[model samples]
Target chain A: MADARDAEIDDLINNLDRDYDFHPGGKDNAGYGRDQADNKQQDLQKLLNLWIAERTCPDILPYDEELISTLTDRLRAQVEFIEMTTTDPEAASQSKLKILLVESELERIKFLIRGYVRARMHKIDKYYLHLSTQDTDTKRKLSDAEQRFVLRRATQLKRFYDQRFLSSFPQALQRLDDNSPILPMVDTPDLNEFVFVRVLQDVPGEVVLSNDDSVDLQKGNIYVLPYKAIRKFLRVGEVELV
Target chain B: MALPLKQIGTFLPSEISFLAENTSVSIVPRQALDVLELIGLNLPAMRPMRRVEVPLWVAIILKKQSRCNIIAPTWLSEDSLKAAYEAEASNMTRFSNKLPWEWIEVGELVLTSAPDDLACPPHIIRNLLRDIREIRQAKVRAGLKSLDPTYMQIDNVGAMELNEIRQFVTMTMNELRVLQNGRAEEEAEEEVEQYPGEDSDLEDTLETTEYSIPRDSSNFDDSLRSRSRSAAPLGERRPTSRAPAYEDDEGDEEEDLEMDESYLHTVKDNSSGQR
Candidate 1:
């Protein structure tokens, strides 16, 4: 965190005397003015994308904490820097106005990030059971730290369930197979995996399921099939995933 | 099995499982039949006892006409289903694949649609299917309470059941998440209230966050008036924007007067007003 602040200070100190020749209005990626705005915009865009992914794909791991923390810290430092420059009597009036614009933009982005994280935290806490039981492919959506956290939480949950439900049940109701590890017991629902597909056009062709059973698709029928099975048809607009 | 899916005002898991059940049935024509036109396919003209594939609905129709007999799938039987049910019951901590994915739905479909074809009485088969459903529902309910990941197999579970449980699990999780974030119940309520008025495009850009600025008095008044207009024609057409700020005590009296004026205007406009 201290290193980040020092880097920002170094950037400001080194560039203070350098006259920028590039125009802000021109589509010049190399321009100092354009690059600063573009980088900030990109950061905001990435944050938005992370939030959207978290909401739409419940099975996928939630956004990493480090990303949010890093963004928050960067924005805070930028805000402080802008405040110092804006109030400085030596600072040029035009540059101060530009700094103010940048400050407002940063605040807007931070507001959005804060709201997005809050909303996602709600979902993460709510669907921990389903999320924890997710396969490696889905779990990989989370950061290393989040993955470890979920594993530990899942272990704690397994122990809690075993003590509360399994152990208390009669001997006959207990599991016959003892081979499989109890913690992180696999088989929870992948909430985002299925599609409520409506058969828009008649398909005389058969769909082979995971269990190798063949199903004949017909018009005006709705079925919740696995997304992978009908993704091709969805792409061609033959089926609508409602 | 986990507890039966709660009444989430959506399709039950059983109904989803029922819809998801394979509807295609293998049938054999008892006599030479011309079914090309009836079946909507270029199925070769069947000779006596020739096997033909058709949907369950088509099979039922053909059987009703005495043109063909339904060939029950290998999975449909009293003994096999009983064994499957037993396996599911015995294995409380693991998902059982002893029965086909749509066992309960398929059994009910066959028994209800073509009972006479079965070796046993329809009622007997119906009772057996009911028993299996009850046990399965009980299992689902238990799974919910225990958060039984093993018993809560979404793929093997029916759509109705999955959707029902999904709503509950998701809702519970969201509540916990909100609590962890230090949000109160009213904040959650306010968020939900804002959803319908929110733009779909903005929702995407905001990542489903309620980032749109909170409604101010003017916008709130406009919405309230619009809602009231749609709900009742007798409501006043007062210019809500011109109304004094709602915080003023006198503003309340002016609002009441407007309502009264509108009521009186309605009565005056109707010359032959009844009652």
Candidate 2:
């Protein structure tokens, strides 16, 4: 039931949105229905941004639970759609061509997911010690699965070190989280690491680099700054790491 | 095993090119094709001679099959490229913000895949892009000398250019931040003096991220987490129209079944003919 092909296909593919019930007042937005195309496009862009951010940011960002779950559901539907479309005998040549397009897009999204998750896993592996001992609120930033993985990884890595070399060291030396005055054993992301950020909105106030120097954060301008200096801006969506 | 040390925190040139392919370009399909119900976005039906927007990757596929002509983005036109080249060349101290973020990747892709579709000769566009890239790269190299520990403002830097300078700029700035911090610490100034921007907001955000860093072992060790208040907002909505219909997939499945039977009949005829 459709007035045009665009509307028809929009309904066909976007039924998953309704199934998820995430768009609580699905109809509240006057034309939220037809905007599926835009939503999907935006979601893709959001995923790309996340993948880039995860790769470049010094600290592990909060896990995007809602976005990932919605996308995972859509990926499943498309996979099923592909299975149905490829087997249909009508539009044999046409369907084959369409299948190619579908498959290509499917692979693109798959690549994005793999890149995003892999980057997160790599960070988790790097910072497990810090993550394991951090406050609960800090650990909650990771997905539940990641939380489990961090614990197991941190425990196993510590055990391995103990078996390999720590057993020979003094009791005090065996501790991984030794907050030594000079140097600590735990590895943490360098918050002071420099990152390139593309400003999304004008910063509320001038950013003070020090007592004397201040830089205006204008929209649509890219700046290279320590992740710590712009961390709040990145969170408030005033800027994004390029 | 760990990721390759060098590859860590870096993207290969080819990867950037691949990412660029997702951006849309205009195309006129020579042969009509049914709609593609893709996972990411639903592409509308393509009709002959009716120009439509499609992802660059799709345009490349259609162009390779001789089924469509890619409409090069206006910026890739000879006049635009020439203008951009001149603007960039004249601005020795700064990079003119003329090109798109994906300019380098998109320009190369279109030139290679559908050169015949461009308004001017491919070489002209290629040469212009090359000239612009050269001037901008030189500027990028020179800009490193002025890099401040606080921030490096280089507008209109191409994706590829950013990657090339990424390792060097990040390392140098990081070292500078540490040295500056050490000096600031010796002065016995509070940590708030070290960071710029809204102090309260910065502290609020730091509480959420729960950082693990600093000192670099030449020396580093500190925890800077606090009470959390706000979570960052999610993706915002864009303007779109129409009251959505609440149709179930039950109808689509029926339509699929009918098409299936009809297609099976055609398949039988073809198989019979072959036999």
Candidate 3:
């Protein structure tokens, strides 16, 4: 039975990878499809269970209801989209509206999750109040109850948030293709070889260049030095050794 | 009373003859003639050398023409003057008293008094002036001393007075209400801050102590252990034992040879294991 269970687990994991088209080393590039939809749903359920386990408080539980509902609605829409795509492949091919809708829903879910986390952090401060109060039997009892509630609810909220993140990760990675690089490349210098030295202001070059043999030259006079060697020996500006 | 022509020094003989014929003698003060001239009144220039009593009719004409002296001629009898003063006072007092009350009513409804009504008629001018003065004094006593004098004009006086009182009351009430509201809001906020949600507190403590601590410590321990494991064998050059020993004739030599052989075999085994 244990072996069967292990096999089932492995199969589920394989299905998850195949359904979502998740390449462990490669970039996540899963498109909207039935298999992707199933993977997303499973991921969401796992996240929900994790969050439920984390949540300790009833009050905090209610707080996550709206978040859960929003996530569920988003997932449901994606499921419907997948079904529609399967039924009418031609229509789905022409209409990019489903993709846009999914993207918007994903963005909304992300914002909601962020807001929920912030609110939870704020509540955490309030949660400390009861613990800090004068130690009495009644107070302790109340505090214990509150602690349980918060612990349970916060855990649940975190699980849901994590699931949403996991489900959306593939889509987010695909969206990265739209991003353009904005930085220029430059060779990085080795830290150990570089050393700072003081030079006279009247010198043609303010930099004092020194080698392992203690041979020194003004940076401007070192024209024969290789670019990489010059880079190593010359300090661009004033720097403290410490 | 008739006087000798010679006794009235510098009297022209023709002027004396003219005064002597008139029964109702009008004595026009010399100041009156100066006032008439100052008012740009047209009159005959008399000789400075002559002093003459003017006829009543001529005096009346000069007085009527003069704009310099706003007061009526004083030559009239006391009874007539008193009667005229009383009539003027009564007429003015009546108009001043009635006009303000009417204006006050109109102002209560926020209506503007007509310009014709605002400009107090000639008869009631003095009374209007007195009423304006009284209103100014009242405003000062009420601590609204900075009120404009034009505020006392019939057009604005009633409304201004009403608004001033209204503003004073409204401002006082608004300030009190704001203070009260501020205090109430502060108290409510403080109460909310003090509200004790005991259950959440216990949960937080447990989460920090039981859950977070173990998880964090386990993660730290795992990292530490991995680091130590990776660094341990590198620090020591001693060959690991868990391999077959090579027997030789010399026991020490055999042990040393076994160590070297095992080390090589382990390296080979490790390489094969990696593949």
Candidate 4:
């Protein structure tokens, strides 16, 4: 059910689990205990990442329905298990300390998730037009709900423009043709221009653009190519935008 | 002509994702003690050896004082990083979620701030990090070779590397999308060639103010033209209105042909209104 987005969410979850363990491993209680701890941590971060993803890209399809409930259940079980378990003073104190860290992290993650969502909603409401007609690739960033919202908004805008602005304008002033599909006017930031990229390696390669012009990419030197020319290199991480 | 499109910077997915990222760090205090009255701290007690999660700056301060040992995040480890690199390298078609949102920066931060606390030497970790980043980047290039821009997930990646990739990927995806829809190619290829020419243009345009226009907008050229045109007796209106039509016929030639239609529309609107 969870596809490409799965890997990133899982990565964050796994990190939270592995990074927060305070238990120093011994023979009897090494891998198994750590595994349980790791799962608990992973579960929490999974939720955090899900919230973050929703907030960051509200236009994408929503997350798997069962993911949150399953994680929350597992987390609850883990908390109960921790509470019931008994140990020596050192290990008991350590678990107590570990729990605090996990809870604090959870709080921090929630705060950030809240802030991110608020910021995105502000942008979405403010630039609903930009969000609506964003190229499909960019629109993929929106969650299903957001996608629906943008679609509705796009239709409303198309109608508003068709009835009000486009109807009033003469053929010379009108941009889209009469038969052309009505998409909300796209106000995309220009992406085909040169960007400040610092070459990260020494691999020298040649890039051919739409015009069949080749630009040489030499590592350790920064060269500004029409983004079209070096789009491939940028993705491969050979060049970093400064 | 397209209604004057807004050149909003925050609209970029990369920029928004960068802003949304959580770069906060957590550290375990080395020694616990009674709660001392600190100006910002709201905590009732400070226990030794307890994990006190703090912002990156606060973590830095505590680490500097040798008061806490930074819990090197899992993504910073050699084995996990290598695994992530392999995942990224093996699949050119997709960006793996093997690393955190700000994985590169987090790894760099931990290495720079708490080298001694890590399982391996800082230099070795640095080398490993470099290898991973390079491999993943190479994979991105390989993905681009397919010409199916759908495979690229710009959101999964972040930090400095994403900035360069974002511009290209966003443009490419946008171009391919418009091409499929049979729309006019608004994705104009500008004067990115002649690196020196681009730099000179930027320098010439940017000399007037300390504020630099973002490189990603066509507005840079618009602003540049407006600056030069500021001397001319066009209207006494704000400089933001599109440059006049007669000026288009005059010596101040436009840099790109794609913007010409919009400019002409502006002229038509201005002329018709004035009459």
Which candidate has the top score in TM-score?
A: 2
Candidate 4 local lDDT, A61-151, one digit each (tens): 2334455455445446545545653345555764554444444444454454454445445456545666675677757656667678767
lDDT of 3 by residue, A28-142 (tens): 5423333455554444443332232122111122233443554666557666765776578686774443344344435434443543343344334333332223245423333
Instruction: List where candidate 3 sits over 4 angstroms from the true fold.
Output: A1-67, A76-92, A129-242, B1-275
In candidate 4 the C-alpha lDDT for residue B82 amounts to 79
- Report the lDDT of model 1 for residue A71: 75
Can you give the lDDT of residue A222 in candidate 2?
A: 88
Tens digit of per-residue lDDT, candidate 3, span B56-138: 33433333433111222221223432344444355332222222312322221111212122223423433443444454435
TM-score of each: 0.35, 0.76, 0.16, 0.38
> Model 1 over residues A1-242: C-alpha lDDT tens digits?
99999999999876864534443445553466445544644565456545433433333344557667767777776677677777886765645433633454465556557555544444444445555666777676565655676668767876886888968865633431111111111323333243445576877688775435556667656555555566667546576543
* Clash counts for all predictions: 19, 4, 21, 13
Model 1 C-alpha lDDT per residue in residues B93-139, reported as the tens digit of each score:
54455555456566666776677887667786677667766777787
Chain A TM-score (model 4): 0.40
Residue-level lDDT tens digits of model 2 in B1-275: 23444545777788789889989999999999876667667787899999999999999999998899999998999888888888888879888877999999999999999999998899989998888888888898789888877777888888888988888888677655555554554355355333321213323333322233332233432322210000000000000110122122213333224233333443454345435
Query: Fraction of reference contacts reproduced per prediction?
Result: 0.00, 0.47, 0.00, 0.00
| Candidate 3, position A109, lDDT | 41
Query: For model 2 chain A, where is the 10-residue window of minimal lDDT?
Result: A178-187
